[model samples]
Target: MSTYKLRQGRTMKSPLVNLAVRRLAIALVTLLIVAFAIFFATQMLPGDVAEILLGQAATPEAVAGLRQAMHLDQPAFLRFIYWLGNLFTGDLGTSYVNNMPIAELIGGRLMNSLKLAGVTALISVPIALTLGITAAIMRGTFYDRLVSILTISVISVPEFMVATMAVIVFAVYLGWLPALSMANEVTSITGLLKAFAMPVITLSFVISAQMIRMTRAAVIETLDTPYIEMALLKGASRSRMVIRHALPNALGPIVNAVALSLSYLLGGVIIVETIFNYPGIAKLMLDAVATRDLPLIQACAMIFCLAYLLLITIADLVAIVSNPRLR
Candidate 1:
């Protein structure tokens, strides 16, 4: 029985499993570093949180008392350690400005951001993958050139510019959609469509451009392999050869591309949310910054960093698992 148990443990120790474990460990370490950086960065920002909260007319004694009550008087390193420990227990600390639990304040805003991101991803992913695959299959044709030129043009434009253009075209010129996305006003399908229209359009365009480019590259790379060439020479149809022979082999890179492209939403959504007056975490973070709300700012920054790390880590694991050589 002991021998069987030992053999079972050995069998479980595959390279892919080892790689995933290592990747997760790395992500945890990266999160910790990011947390430290965020805490300290917020600390370095101008003006004291207590001062900001108390306002200009407050007495020095009141400011000092407020500082001590909020533990602002604590040593920076000690405060960071305390904050990090609380984070382990899911205590995000109270907002210095709002005097509310950071978690409570962020909950709804975070959900809003997630909903926006989910909608954008749902619309963008299928379109990107289909266009990318089709472009790769039709390489050197007019369709391929058209996709290449369009993607390059879109990619060259920043998200803010895209969002601005979307607002101008849809909201100002056409008057087809609202420039602002009011999350709470959506009660019916029409309301939902109106609320999501401009932001989704902007995010979709930016994210789809990147995904298309990367997906096309990955598929094209896979199609150039000797086995793919041999499969084509065996009288396989272009579509069949690509769908059956290339895509499966290229799954690792394609998944990585999708993940990396989606991760752009993290950065891009900040601009999208801000421009459209969307009630999301990014906008909340901006508000927190203006008020010098250290806890809220740190929480929002950590969330973004954590999400970005999680996506990259997942992509790495998928790449490792999907590689035939690794298997």
Candidate 2:
């Protein structure tokens, strides 16, 4: 019997590890596809930065020199093969604008983007879960209706509109927080809180608003499951029944929603980051767009795609752990 139990344990562990490996493989393939897409899309985009920099009045000799210098004269197929080789070797290329290594430029900034994304998720997920659960538990109560209406209202508004209104109400009028910049102006934690208050809250509300709907749906579904009824019949404490039983079951869809929201956040809440001048990834990508820096644009897009892939992969792993049916 002991040997049989040991074999069962190993069998269970094997499948989980196998699932993780499969998810990772899918993520890698997704990133490769993103790189290919970015390359072709950027190539097709009109306007040669080389010509723009050198001007149309420049001689053919100058044009040729610039093309050779930038490797534009290379055949498109050869360039893609070279690009793919470098990507596999972990080279994203130098930034056209800064002449800095792609890795170096993104390394520090990605952390800041991670910071904002992390904090935003931290703030949003709990509130969404709580409201959703409460709405489910209460069912037809006034509070449930109110929460549903409020979340719907928030979901109806765009992030940019929310950011603009937050800036106007909190920063422009109430003076509760600074309208722009998460820079070194905040020397203390309190100062930072005061500065981040509007930006964080605005993004959180916008994100959580949608999450509330997803959470409500998940929890409602969990409540309807036969196991929940069995738990109640067995006289399980309400708190334990809800927290230990229903909560875990409800978490799968909630996890998926959070992963999707993180993908959205990584694009950098254009309005929120812009309003606060946060200098996160989205704003950086926008700057890349305006300047037409092909390498930077491609690198940034690839980063977002890879980040989204990672988020979804994590969500899938979590779902698998929480619900054994997936295995």
Candidate 3:
């Protein structure tokens, strides 16, 4: 009997493991496709790297020599092959403009971006989740209506617009925070606040608004299920019913909502970082574009894509594992 039960447990676990493996494989394939697309897209950008680097006074012969030296004289396909091969070996190559190794150049910038994203997430998640759950618990009340209206309003505005307003209100008019974030100058607690303040606020407002809406939807959907209703009918307090019965079952959807909303940061941070002049990977990529630095651009693009894929893959795994049927 014990052996039969052990066999049954293994049988139930195998499908989930298989699904996880499949998901990982799909993510890898998707990443490859995305990398291919990113590589070719950058290749199509107008302007020659050799010309851009050499300036207008450069002779044709000089440009040809520079191209040859940089291996830009090679066919696009061969260059792409070489780039992709290096990518698998963790070699991001050197920047055309900076003439520095891409990894070394972007290391601090990537950390800055991560810091911004992390602080924004830390501030936004709990507030958004609390508001979402509260709004779900108070559905149809004036408070619920108010929360809904506010979240929708915030969501309707673009991040750049939001960032602009934040700069104006906080920096230009009030003069409370700096117009631009000087991340390198941070030293004391106050300096840290001054550095991260405006960017974090801009990012948080946008991220939280989306999270609140989705979290509310997920919770409310769970609340309407039959089991929750039955729990309430059996004298379980509404709060208790939701906290105990509804929330646990709603975990899958809630996690998915969080993941989807956070994914917005990948795109939104670009605008935020640019607006505030924050020293981050997005800003690095933008500068790289102006100089037609393909290696740097490709690396930044892949980092964003890989991060997005990771978030989505983790969310999928959580949802799969949380499913009662799968259990």
Candidate 4:
């Protein structure tokens, strides 16, 4: 009997390891594809980097010399191979406009974006889960309907519009927070939080709306399960029943929903960041595009894609661990 249990443990462990290895392999392959796509897209972008750098009135000979100097004369395939080799060796190449290394350009901006997402998640997740669970517990009541209506209403508004409205109300009308996040650099904790206030709220409201709906659905389904019904019949207090049974059962799906929202935050904050002039990966990508900075653009795009893949992979692992059935 002990041997059988040991064998069962080994079998279960093997699959989990295999799952993790498979996910890692997929992530690597997807990153390669993203690299290729970003490179090609940048190559195809209109306007010549050399000309843009040298100006329109520059002689054709000067332009040709600059192009050759930048190795822009090389075929697209060769350039991609060279770039890919450098990427694997930890060199992200240099910008065409300023000649600054891509790594240095993106380092701080990426951290700023991460900080923004973190603050937004901290504010959003608990409230969203509470509202969702409350709605589920009061599933057929007026409170449930009210929560449903509120979340749906928030979801209906586009992020940029929501951001605009928040700036108008909180910055212009209320004079509480800064309208622009450009100078909201994080020198100190208080300054950081104050600078992040409007952007965090704007992002949280939009992100939390989807989470609220998903959490409500997940918890409601869990509540209807046999275990929950049995707990109720055993006269388990309402709070205890939900806290111990329903919430645990519902946690897997809630985590997945939050992960999905986090992935969105990582890559989908372009408009919000742009509107507020916030320094972040999305904003850096925008600047790269505007300047036709091929190397910088590719680096930022690859980073965003990798972040998204990582988040989903983490969500899958968490779900498997939280739900024994997945094992």
Q: Each candidate's lDDT (Cα)? A: 0.92, 0.81, 0.92, 0.86
Model 3 C-alpha lDDT per residue in residues 1-327, reported as the tens digit of each score: 999999999999998899999999999999999999999999899988899899999999999999999998999889989999999999999998888999999999999999999999999999999999999989999999999999999999999899889988998999999999999999899999999999999888898999999999998998998988899889999779988998888898889888988899889999988988999999999989988998999999999999999999999999889887888
Clashing pairs in 3: none
Residue 300, candidate 2: alpha-carbon lDDT: 82
How well is each residue in 51-127 modelled by candidate 2, as lDDT tens digits?
A: 76677898888988988998999998799889889877899998877888888887866766777777888888888
Worst 10 residues of 2 by lDDT: 262-271
Tens-place lDDT digits, model 4, residues 71-160: 999999999999999989999989877788888888888888988888898899999888988999999899999999999999899898
State which candidate, 2 or 4, has the greater lDDT: 4
TM-score for each candidate, following the candidate numbering: 0.95, 0.91, 0.97, 0.92
RMSD of every candidate to native, in Å, equals 2.5, 2.2, 1.2, 2.0
Cα RMSD for candidate 2?
Answer: 2.2
For model 3, state the Cα shift of residue 8 in Å.
0.6
Q: What lDDT score is found at residue 224 in candidate 4?
A: 89
Clashing pairs in 4: none
Which stretches of candidate 3 lie above 4 Å from their native place?
none
Q: How does candidate 2 score on lDDT? A: 0.81
Best by TM-score: 3
Query: Ranking under TM-score, best-scoring first?
Result: 3, 1, 4, 2
